[model samples]
Target: MNIKFSPVPVEDRERGRNGNCYNPGSPLTEGMKKQFMEEIKPICIEMERKYGVPAAFLGGQAVNESGFGLTRTGYFANNFCGLKFVGAWGRKPPQIMNGQDFGVETYQLIGQPDEAWDGSVRIIENLGEDRLIFDESSRYDNRYFKFKSKPEFFDFLCRITYLNGSEGRLYPKDLRYIFDEYRQNIQRGMSIRESCSLVACQLGKSGYCHTEEGNGTPPQRRCNYYSRVITEAMDEWNTYEWTKIALTQN
Candidate 1:
């Protein structure tokens, strides 16, 4: 099915909103989300068409976490969903190469993200001012992977969600989105909401946010809210696109 991700592309999700997730007057506005949606439209469509997980669900995840590309962390770090850096995150002990401080950490884009070495991954560094230089010899600590482009970053998120399996007895059981489990729903042809619920439930159990209820006090911990908010945003985005199609078709 040739699904065109064309939506009139509403006002950037980041701009002029009553109640948004992060701080008010955030720079990354809804307008940014509109662009991001188009930018990643191909990737999202490929994901949904190839696999059966609704593209809206994935869109929601990105919109929910990174505010559709208006987040400093996700923007500068290329970490669209706030995937923390862990386990050999940076150079083993940093290095000093010919009077220059350096460190080389395995690229986390592909392969098992662990001590295990993957020959294909390329190690690079963020050399300030939107400059990413190849420094396999650098030992200086590096945070999350700063993707070269929005599409690359989005692709990383998709692969992770569709790959990883059950983590051993370390942290929470369902602390991350297990794509294998989601694949079942994909095979069964689940609705977008169902897919959202399934992934949202797992995300709740994981790091989406604390699920425990409180007096809406400090932090106001609530599980699955992240997924809910993102999914809703994604659904609305789809509506705009669908609405455009409806009007044109008529």
Candidate 2:
């Protein structure tokens, strides 16, 4: 399913211009990467276990939303994926992005865990399978449409690449390539343990960091150290399960 298109280094910026949002560059920052390990990694593990979705999807989605764990809202909301509301199993998803007077686009911030976690499993199930068909009149493209089934979705994206005067394609092949890219990035990352340790160290220095609420803040001097420990624990927990999944090939 490997597909290639002209590299649009400016595509993300274009999405921003069109009021459609996309991740910019690497999603996580150094400090926030630490925080992600300390705080958010566990949920990703659970997502793998319960949803039967690949850890990579969760990881990528988080990377997409949190801007690689940089933005403050992304840090607090624990939303790494900018999952918009889909009602009736993909019938009509309301416009979730708002535009400013100058036409700058803004996305709605989700706060609750349920806001993201509940429906994401379904989205993940369709990941790299669903295709985006553009409609010139639809808001998201005015005529942009998501196909109901994977095969149809895939073909639709392929068909439209040369249709409607567009130069790019978004078919299954493209999806596969993107997934491969994401996996490669994950594979190149530090081992879960090391990443968590880095995060935990930062948390310990902060002294006020806790994955779940109610864990009181520690002193500033030791906060970074404690954070590292917490992150390591979380990493261990996630990695253990992720390992099981890998071994079983489930």
Candidate 3:
């Protein structure tokens, strides 16, 4: 069962009529959802191979965090996991921009006049960072890491998501314990969906934002909601045609 991987279509990657990758007001279509899953499947597979994290779990998190890559942080910053840039791993803290701290330059491909002066050429530039001041979406605050590519984003996501507790705030004791529990579940031969549900519950209990509630929901409710959503997503992906084929190979 060989699954052919493909890049996201240029139109899907480009800014929509509202000047972002997909209009915020518009509902995400089935096509968009399928495209997002196709684009991320390879990256999730690679992360699973490297980190022992289940690909279904990673895919579910990406779906939950990014709204299937429709959110500003997910699409513009390539940060599918809702990771905040806290100057961890000795990285320099991002500079403030437009009254917002933790600013990172974000790049997007746009059509510009070609060198020949005849036709427009697609060039990647830091246009997204410039748009932050005017964009009213609270999620577009420029406070997340900006990656040049999806692979780079997923690699960093894996590191922080499964970090040990040597660092204080960035990799806290509870997060480390969550990672250990996930590993233990895997070692115990738990199904990916089951393991992801348990980890999602742990994340909710540890005050992680697995959904967009943003401290509005009660901890117990949030835990149940996050776990349910994650488990549902894993179940869907486990049955998806490509994912089923990919899992056969695995």
Candidate 4:
């Protein structure tokens, strides 16, 4: 699989409001988005193998979160999926890269702390004793997890954000019904885009697909909005002939 990274054009970046480059409401052209997806195709395949999350879903997420790698975090920090750094979890702290302070915004976990795939807690229990300092505002500097490389960012994104046992475990129990229903549609030769979109909608309804904790009442409206955006983005990638071939080969 040929892999290539295409930076968003300077003019396109300038078109966005403020100093930011990409605007979600007015995203990049379809051709540009397709090129971006093509470049990340191999990473998506690797993630699917390691995490069990479908590659199509991963690609769709990249599109949804970063606007095809045009957002400030995506273009500058290489942080896709809008994954924020809660704590180091024994890893190095987020560093400054390309003038972006990776550790700037502090996040309070919505619910009980969950363990990641590696057994590290997402929200560190002890902040003061954990070698972390408060920012100027006297707040913890737990901002976005910036990556020096795309692969590293994606790996962390999948391992920490998506592989939590809450949602991950739900896959076999709560999510199985939806998956089983879609299994037939997929096996029946439904188009990948359609199948992905339908599954996304169902996942939204289940309310188990969010990256954050505190799964309560399903946010039908928000989830459906996310599904629509993700589905449309995945559908865009599906338009590429190579997507079908690549998906099959994977």
Best by lDDT: 3
lDDT of 4 by residue, 68-144 (tens): 77766676678776554534332332232112343333222122223223333333222322222112221222244
Expressed as tens digits, the lDDT of each residue in 135-163 for candidate 1 is 33332222344566666655555544343
CA shift of 154, model 1, Å? 2.4
Off by over 4 Å in 3: 1-27, 86-142, 164-174, 210-218, 239-250
What are the per-model numbers of colliding residue pairs?
A: 15, 29, 0, 0
Please, what are the lDDT tens digits per residue for candidate 2 over residues 1-250?
Answer: 2212221212322222221223233333566456655454445444434433334334433443345544333333222333222221123323421233223233332111122222331221111212222221222211123223223322322233212114333221222333233334346864544433433344234332333222354455355545444444444335444434542553
1 or 4, greater by TM-score:
4
Model 4: how far is 161 from its true place, Å? 2.0
Question: Per-candidate TM vs. native?
Answer: 0.52, 0.30, 0.61, 0.53
Minimal lDDT window, size 10, model 1? 1-10
Alpha-carbon RMSD to native, per candidate: 13.1, 19.6, 11.3, 11.2
Candidate order by TM-score, decreasing, is: 3, 4, 1, 2
Better of 3 and 4 by lDDT: 3
Candidate 3 lDDT, 104-183, residue by residue in tens = 45433222112112222223433342221222222222345677778888876666546542332433433666756776
Candidate 1 stretches greater than 4 Å from native: 1-30, 49-53, 88-142, 165-177, 186-189, 208-223, 239-250
Clashes of 4: 0
Select the stronger candidate by TM-score from 1 and 2: 1
Order the candidate numbers by lDDT, best to worst: 3, 4, 1, 2
Candidate number with the higher lDDT (1 or 3): 3
Most TM-score-accurate candidate: 3
In model 4, state the lDDT of residue 14.
Answer: 27
